[model samples]
Target chain A: MGTINVSREYSVKEKMFLPAIIQGMIITLKRFIQGFIFHKKYTIMYPEERRNYSQRFRGMHFISVDENKVENCTACFLCETVCPAECIHIVAEERDSASNPYGVRKEKKPLSFDIEVLRCCFCGFCEEACPKDAIKLSRNYELSILSRQEGIYDLNHLKREVKGRG
Target chain B: MSSYEISKSENYLNYCSDKIRPLPVTGPDAKPLPKMTLDGQVVEFVPGDTIMQVAERAKVASRIPRYCYHPGLSIAGTCRMCTVEVEKAPKLMTACSTPATDGMVVRTRSEKVLKSRSGVVDCLLASHPLDCPVCDKAGECELQDYDYEYGPSRSSFVDEKRVFPKSSTRKLSDKIVLNMNRCVACERCVRFTDEVTKTNDLVMLNRGWKKELTVGDEDKGLYNDYQGCLSDFCPVGALTWSDFRFQKRVWFLRGNASICDRCAKGCNIEVHSEKEIIYRFVPIYNPKVNAHWICDEGRLSYKMVTNSHRVIAPLLEVAGHGPTATSWETLIPVTASLLKNSSRALLVLGTDSTMEECENLRKFFSKFVQNGEIRYFNGTGITTSSENKALDHLLRQNDKTPNTKGVESLGLKPLDVAGVNGFDTVILFRSGRAGIPSVAAAKNLILWGVWSDEEVRAQKNVRALLPGLATQEKSGTFMNCDGILQSFKKAVEHRGYGLDVTRIIEKF
Candidate 1:
């Protein structure tokens, strides 16, 4: 294929870039006047204030806890199976009989439940696949991590008190 | 070893349940078999075969569901889930107990039959604890499968369900755990212990709604080699293998065909694994080998591969220190030089090796080493195949290695009874199942194949270690104790830095 360059000579108005610069300055001046005088702001101070996201918005995952602070996850692996990004990993173990007075209802517990937030696509399928309403995606979207290892949320982190999906 | 089709073997014919066998037609006195109509399909069966058997012969056994009707166990006709509508009969007949008559028309999926099965499932579910999340047999449980297929969406019984609190999570044995609340009271385990194993270890304690499963001799406590089989055939989550209790959910696993190498029986097994990590070994229904059972030893043999101390990477000894993990690049040349320098080298092939491996090593050693003598060593009590005996009447054999007969059939001579005495360099090759031979007198020892850290550390003078694949990780044929040649595909990928014998030899 031959190249067809649509190169054209600049007109006098376009060649003189002073008008374009002045137009850009006028728009900036209008925004400055709106913000400085009228006190109209488009963005907030992110550290002090937060935006309101939809209640259904899928963010970081958390395992719901019961009245006694015991995680509701039986580690049925439904979440791990439904995860599209393959980020959810769980190890299941039998709950000790001494601590498990609830009998078959809470007989199994997750020995280790890990979610790699870096790899998670935040699809919220794990929340839907969970039978006991154990794993749910909370509205806490601040997921900054210092290291790659910090991105993996363990059972302890996942079992944090998430009051009504945060 | 002659490769024979597993389906046509005499052991398969013998192992087949006599209650549900096809009529003999080969002999001169053989006559045409009786025929029956099942769900509009005509199927041939022996005279005494049940309606379930006729449907099985026609490959439509799934049309009928029975909690108590295991092919390997005697028919109890207690579940009443296999009810089918026979045209002439006034009431629905249980397919598992009723013998098929010639020219009888049976409708397995009739509305009446469906209602009857739904009723059976509803009754069973009335007392069945909804503990599938904690149940080990959740994915493969027959009750769950039947409930999904033929059960009512909700039960009518609102009364308090029966609960045996003491027996709910009772440990029947070290190998099995019994959850009485989850049982459908199929009594398949009791029947299995009574008929198959003849151990009489388990029994139905009470009668009717309060019927419970408990060890016959509480102190004896399920003392049977085939205790794993009870969990295998249990229709519900009542009896579960303790080893695989909460290890993994069955639906997440992927199964591949393999052979158990813990004994010479060579039971065909389905290696259930996920992401190259094996979770458990369940027996594949091979009538010629392990009909429907695998011993606890073989069922739990995946630990050998997944052992934490297993040496995966190749190792080489430093100046005076013990074997240290090293790359194959540096270890191969060093091993070849050691083999070349030794005046008399002996290669001891562990009888656990497959036929192809033995052949490969025998051919490789003949051309590779100067004065190398290759010999087979089965350090598991018996040195030769002739001395190997059955530990039990069932699957367990006296020979711990899987392929002693196979290695012996290769024309390889057994090592001297005195063990490795005067060899300059001794190469011991195994696949983790074979016992280690005494090498106290050897100057330099080269350990190959699957070895744990303790095995390598126990040796006096170990020069180098070469890691190889376990039985489940590699594809090979085995000559079972019965001289049946069964070839298995690779079940799982080797989760290690181990190399194949052929590749290791090629690299050298």
Candidate 2:
């Protein structure tokens, strides 16, 4: 069977495309002039410029710490239980009484706290469920990882100092 | 009373309230007991039952809150949590200590009773640290539950809570940690040691506001076999099991009913686990078996399955270097060939094995070995079920194996130590609780069932290893020391490449 070409002929306005090209150029030039001269930029220079997020924005997770720098987490498992994505895994252990001066307040501590950022839905349930106000989400959304293992933030990683919501 | 006598006694009581006591279904010939009006519902009760017991028999005991009214311990009406409004009585009477009379009327949740409970809770909370975030007993603490149900939302007293400075994190013993600030002064632990264990290891020191719990013998320090029971019945986080202290929160644990296989007493237990990892074993109330308490050894027996050294995969002895971890595909054929080629094989089943496993192994080995003899071994010193005896006054048995009586009931003979020499190859099967028999005479040894790395390494003549599931990972029936048949379902999934006995036999 022969191939059928359903081609239609162009009108004068379509055949003469200089006006259309100039119209597109004019819009580009308007944006360029606005960005360069007026400094009204629409896109950010990402590595240097960042978008301002609200205080409640949920991103990477972290464990809160006290003035002594010891984690405030009592390892109550409330966050693990409330996590909708089931990404949080924790192992709790008693703080050595010899080293722990806070007595009953800092008695129990997390032996291992892991959060699979890849699996986490960033729902902020963990932050809400945490009784000790330990687990929290920061506004630092730079979560790109080179490997799968990097996505799993461990106790040491989560214990990293985060100033407020960062 | 000794644990044996406690188990045999018809009037065995539990730490729980009588509300859990199921009333006997009345038959035509059954004697009619006196009736009492409990919460406007007419309920029959035994002649000597207290108001609390009557409520329990009526299955409405939950309506009454309790602090020091454990069925296993003597009544101490100090907390005043179980007070009820009696129709004729001008004052609210304590249900635990007050006996029920014929045609007596009681209101368990009257406004007066609720006000009384709220008062008691308020007093308890006045001294309570309320550090539930770090308390191990947070989810199961009666103080927390009662406070939620009947306590006043706000407190009247604004004074700083009483703190037992030194005793706040005192080590009562290696098994228990005492946080004095969390104690509600229920004195249940004191009563438990005094009445039940009878060791009198713990005592309430001082009077009123300054009251504190201290070990009777400070140097000896809570040296009772049943110390774990103290933590089990403790209504608050005052007494917490150290093994489970910070392991996991109680709310995250999922409990499944299983029997403690550490001893022949076979105390019924609830295996508390999360994600197939056991956290602890708490005794389930079985009046005829273990009544609301298990020994510390049994409670901590879950470590055998969770031990890091436990061999989980098939191991094969290569180049006389010893057993090395290998896959089932390669190990199964080697195990089958070894069994098939052996001239005279001896299958020594550890008495810790369930009756089903013992019988299954016997049948499977008989088919696999042309000239084979199947025998049971209890290497915890006892050779026969008749030789087994109670080690303690409580539930601990001298016979460490859980099913020596069970294996015997299956018509299997005990392993003759001298007879182990005649066999060319010996297959030693156990579930980690049974002691290893002296089978050094056997030239070729095939280790099967839960074996730790150290246990596997000790054997010089071992050929291949077949790792198997522990008691918590499998379902089976065990005939306890008393010849009582108790069956348990798998408490957790086997976190290993180990196959069931039937599955292993099928591969053979």
Q: What's the CA error at residue B286 for candidate 2, in Å?
A: 0.9
What lDDT tens digits, residue by residue, belong to model 1 across residues B1-508? 4664322232332233754465566788877887888888888787888888777766677778888888888889988888999998999999999998889999999999899889989999998878787788989999999999999999989989899989988998899999999888888888898888889999888798989888999788889988888888888889999998899889989988788999999988888898989999877777667877899899989999899999999999997777988999999999999999999999999988989899898889989898889888888888898998998777899999999988888888999876777788999999998889889899999999999999999997999999999999887888988899988778889878898899999988
Positional deviation of B329 in candidate 2, in angstroms? 2.9
Chain B TM-score in each of the candidates: 0.96, 0.94
Q: DockQ for candidate 1, please give it.
A: 0.66
Candidate that would win on lDDT: 1
lDDT of 2 at B383: 90
> Mind giving the per-residue lDDT tens digits that candidate 2 earns over B321-417?
6788899889989988888888999998999998889878988987778999988888887899898888767688899889998898889888874
Query: What residue pairs are clashing in model 1?
Result: none
Worst lDDT run of 10 residues, candidate 2 chain B, spans: B1-10
lDDT of 1 at B233: 81
TM-score of each: 0.93, 0.89
DockQ each: 0.66, 0.67
Off by over 4 Å in 1: A1-29, A44-53, A145-147, B4-22, B25-30
Candidate 2 i-RMS (Å)?
0.9
Which pairs of residues collide in candidate 2?
B18-B56, B19-B56
